[model samples]
Target: MIGFVILAIIALGGGIGVIVARQPVHSALFLIMNILALAIFYILLSAEFLAAAQVIVYAGAIMVLFLFVVTLLTAGKDDREPKENLAGQRLTAGILAVLVGGGLAVVGVLYPSRAIGLGLPHNFGNLRGMGVTLWGPDFIYLAAVALMLLTAAVGVLVLNRPRRQVKPAPRLEERES
Candidate 1:
């Protein structure tokens, strides 16, 4: 319970940091923090499979892709102040935030203990069972997905790579000059 509260604070702080970060990379890093905290929460709830998936898929692969895209796309860009002409945007966001917070607060008040896994099936999130299934009849699908992810990562890298800009060899006349 104490650990959950600490993690909740960290997650909230990371969420705020992601929103308030000035740089896109910083925002991505903050989002990674928030994601990892959520994964830890899953671990605390004994959802090992979810925690592993969250860390490996979201924090590892997705975050890497996000950082790569953010850095590569924004490379050599001039920093300019954003033109915020959306009047009352902040006011509207604040009101929505307050409403959402109130709803959550009421839920928390109703379920103070926040019971988890009330009617879950046996071995519902067991990692061993998932591995057996994936490696048994689902190996082909897993291989396909892995190939897709590899191709995507390669494509993003290729897109962001600097072109060699090779120049034609100087002609004889130009070389003589």
Candidate 2:
């Protein structure tokens, strides 16, 4: 109850931060915070495997990928233009977003779902089930995809790494002085 509320606030706050963040890296970090909060929510919902997957996949792999791309994009950017001209636009967008969100909230509260739940199946969110599925016939495809993505990320990093600027050797005339 209380935990859910706290997690909800955290998730919402993180999501809002992600949207309003000026820097791509900061946005990615805020997204990670939101992802982590959702992972906790999955645990609260008795979906342990989902929680783990949320943290491992989204918070870990995807966030790293996002950071890699952000780093690659911003690495050489030393200067940026002032954003004062967009202040009015930002405020207007914020107000419109709040109004739309509030309207949706009101509609949801006024008309809640009345459908009965079918509930989770046996071992629905258990790790063993997920492990078995991963190790099943399609394991090769999954493994190959994972390998390719990881290799690609590493390759990008290696290719884009900063190289040291080396000075050339002095000529005989300069060395004589």
Candidate 3:
């Protein structure tokens, strides 16, 4: 319960950070915080395998890719400013945030300690069971993840590939000489 509270606070803070941050790199870092908080929640729920996978796959690989893209695409600090006007955007976002927050608060009040009643399934946190479940019933998802990672790898490679250079022609007198 205490763990859940901590994780929820961290997740909320990260959510706000991601929204309020201006720099792409800062936003990516905030996203990493959110992923880590979620991983902690999984751990608290007795899903050790899922927690590890979340940290490894999301916090490790995906966030690394995000940072790489931010670094490669932005080039420098000069590119951190907003590309478009933020006029009236804050009001809309604030309204949406309030709606979501109110909905969540209502749900929390209605279903307090709801997860406590969920009995742990057999082999809930067992490594072998998780392995079998992943490789057996969820192989398609695993394959999809592999393909997605492959696509992201290809994207990174393409993005970072050096541009072709074109040499300027010599002046007429130098060419003639």
Candidate 4:
């Protein structure tokens, strides 16, 4: 219960930060907070490996990349201009939120007493077990995921970096004459 409350608070705070912060970098940091909160929730659900992976991937690597981008870009220090075009998108977002909220409300009302399955042993969080699962049988999937992330990171770096121009050497004076 306490874990859930903490997660809820963190998530709410992160959401508020993301919306209220004017700087894109700050907003991205808030998103990192949200991802970390989710990782904690995964830990609470006894998914230690998943929680660690979430932190490493989302909070560490992805957020670092976001910071790199924020640094690389030339967004001004001033607060971002308010968007007049947001009204349409805001309405759509609000409608989607309502639909999701309504679904959750219905589920809570209909199955208030529903229980979830908690699988596995106490030692499931051990590194050995996780390693075995990752390398022993699911190696292909793991390799694929790693490859995808590497490709994406490389692609982003390549796309964002400034390109260099090759300058031609000047001809000798005699040759020109």
The Cα local distance difference test for each model comes to 0.88, 0.87, 0.86, 0.84
TM-score, candidate number 4: 0.64
Model 1 lDDT per residue over 1-177, tens place: 799889998999899999788788999999999999999998887778989999999999999999999999987787576788888998899899989998997998788663553666566567876777789889999999999999999999999999889887768556643
Put down candidate 3 lDDT per residue, 1-177, tens digits, no spaces.
Answer: 677778889998998999788788898999999999998888877899889999999999989988999899987657455565568887898999899998999998788886778898778876877878779999999999999999999999999999888776567557643
lDDT of 3 at 136: 91
The lowest-lDDT stretch of 10 consecutive residues in candidate 1 is 114-123
Where model 1 places Cα greater than 4 Å from the true spot, the runs are 112-120, 129-177
C-alpha TM-scores of all predictions: 0.64, 0.62, 0.68, 0.64
Ranking by lDDT: 1, 2, 3, 4
Residue 31 accuracy (lDDT) in model 2 = 98
Provide the lDDT at 159 for model 4. Answer: 98
Give one digit per residue, the lDDT tens place, for model 4 in 109-166.
7886535654575457667777888898899999999999999999999999997886
User: Model 3 clash pairs?
Assistant: none
Q: lDDT tens string, model 2, 54-171?
A: 9999999999999999999897686465668455887898899999999998997789666527676667679876677668866998899999999999999999999889786668
Candidate 3, residue 45: how far the Cα is off, in Å: 0.3
